[model samples]
Target chain A: MEFLLLTEKCIWFGLGAAGFAVLFNVPPKTLIYIAFMGAMGGFLKAILMHFDETNVIISTLCGATLIGFLSIYFAHKTHCPPPVLAIPACIPMIPGKFAYKMMIGLVNLSGNIDHDTYTQIMSETVNNGLKVVFILMSIAGGVGIPLLITRKESSKGMRLRKRS
Target chain B: MIAPSPKNKEIKDLGNVLLNVGAMLLSSGASTGRTRNTISRISDSFGYSSDLLISHRTIMLTISDKKNDYFFNNLKRSAPHGVNFKLLSGISRLSWQVVEEGLSVNQINVQLSRLAALKHYPRWFTLLFVGLAGVSFCRLSDGDALDMVTVFTATVCGLFIRQEVHKMKFNPYICIFCGAFTASLIAGGGLKYGMGFIHEQALATSVLFLIPGVPLINSFSDMIDGNLNNAIVRGLNGFIISFAIGMGLLTSMLIYRF
Candidate 1:
């Protein structure tokens, strides 16, 4: 059951990414490439969290960086912009739960300014809200670093090689 | 007005085509750096020196044939935001072909029109996949099987409404706001009626499809590439979409609470 759960989430993540690829209108040829990237990133994050050794930010950074590296390779092979692959692949890491909780907490706090229950909710809200921002920033930065180094040069070189 | 020379007329026409292509790229959510480079490369292939000034909403392009002393300038606004990687790739390929293959202006125009004419996936197909994606997100977030099924159904219904609203030409914010509201309402209602195992996960993942992943990433890319204006603009746009989504989700919760 444990092993099955591990693989199951990854498969679902990949399928989810394929759905996003279609939504984004990526060419069919590269859909599998993107799904693989998404699966790897999503799986790696889940594994790290399972270990409980690192927090959400670290795990997300690792996963997003993996997506970035693979995006570079796949973008080259497929001749599409790296963003086209990286964006959808990274969507699975967006921390939707935190964002939703933050909003709910805010609504409760607004309705009851001084209640003890509201105070606890407010603290949880702040924690979750901060996690959402930090995790998102980590993912963006993790992917952006690789893209900055390779994306412009590889495309330029490809153009030059074609010209020659 | 002085009668324009033939070379001036030719440059003007090419300028217009370049403007159209640039606007299409920007509107399609191409990063500012990519849009600028592609436009410049395309103009270079046509033997014109060009400068492109891109912001979040507008592109200002000037094409000059310095040897013949011809200059043409045009400003165009970006179209609505949508992501079509095939279109981006097609335009990228077209730019390279123009540069290396020495395609003529008329041939480039033909290819551009063909690429532009490409359509997104069929509406039903998109709706189905978006629903599946929502279900997948629910699972990834550790939602139980029941929650996944609930999210899947809600997402499909919500996205269908979004597609229809878009067809009717509503503002994008309004469309997303309504879509999120509908999706969350379904999920929230389902949980209220004891349809899902996890209420939070169902409500959370149902709106995953509306997350604006591309723009959020592109804003970071734009900032790193030193296109601050475009970066700020894209960032604000992403933030607004997020606000719309939050508003939509809250609206459903509020109704559910009552």
Candidate 2:
């Protein structure tokens, strides 16, 4: 039942990725690559969800890094955009519910600023927000490096061509 | 007008060759200052013409003299009724062409560089994007009724709001809020009414609006074209946008607690 649920989720995500690609006018072959990357990312997210890790930061960072690597490879191989491939893949890893809960806490705290509850809610929100940022940064770094290097090499090639 | 000097003609020929090569390179996915320089050199080889070298679509070249007049005439036809084609020459023509074509690379670079650089987005396109997003949310929500009425209302509202707010030049923050609010209402209402798979199905589809697919693809193109700065900037922007969407959705969900 769990496997069936996972499969259904993966397929839905894949369909979502493909739909976005079509809407954006990405080529068919590139759309397939995006779908594959999204599925992989979703699978990773499912695995991470099962783990009993309390540290959201570390777990998110690791998950994002993996997605980033896979995204970069797919982007390079297919000559499609990394964001197109990576964003969908990383969707599952996004702390969407956590962030939402944090906002709720803030709103509730705002209504009644009793010291203890306020402090606790604020602390939790701040911590969760920071964790989200860290995960995003890691993903960015992982994806950004390959893109930078690839661009640098292409620029160098252009210069050489100009000199010749 | 005097006939151009022989040396000028040779330079012009070289320019033509280079520009053609550059355009071909760009079309084939080469993105560099070098390509622009090559095109520029070609443009400079011949005495500048208002119609031949630049336009709204691209910095096109007239390979022969006959084509030159045709290019200019096309521009003249396109220009506003009162504007005389001859009065507009040099950079002015080039810049006008860029506006006409939209801010594309190669053809519009010279014009784009000169403009005040306000971001331009079409209202219809934004409406379509938002409408699709709303529809996707409704479709993915894991319910039975599919919330057709809600989808229709949201689509119409999104279009109306986008058209009304488009001229205000507001930040994307507004769009994000609107998207989230609409998604939540649709989701909450659908789920509350026992709409079944409608809510679940819509989750995947609604999230499609936040997909950074285009930026990701453009990043690769920029990288391949050797525009590292452009590539990096684009990639970073995409990442931030995605993060913002995720954060926004999460926040909205918590506030309503649906």
Best by TM-score: 1
DockQ per model, Cα: 0.77, 0.05
Error of model 1, residue B183, in angstroms: 0.4
Output the TM-score of candidate 1: 0.95
DockQ of 2: 0.05
Quote model 2's TM-score: 0.51
Give one digit per residue, the lDDT tens place, for model 2 in A1-164: 97886676566555544444444433345657766765665555555655745755555556555656776677557544344455544444444445445555655666757788888888898876677566655544544555555544643553476457
Report lDDT (CA) for all predictions: 0.86, 0.47
What lDDT score goes with residue B223 in model 1?
Answer: 91
**For residues A53-137, could you state the per-residue lDDT of candidate 1 as single tens digits?**
5498999999999999999999879878788888888887888888888887788778847677877887899999999999988
Candidate 1 chain B, which ten residues in sequence have the lowest lDDT sum? B191-200
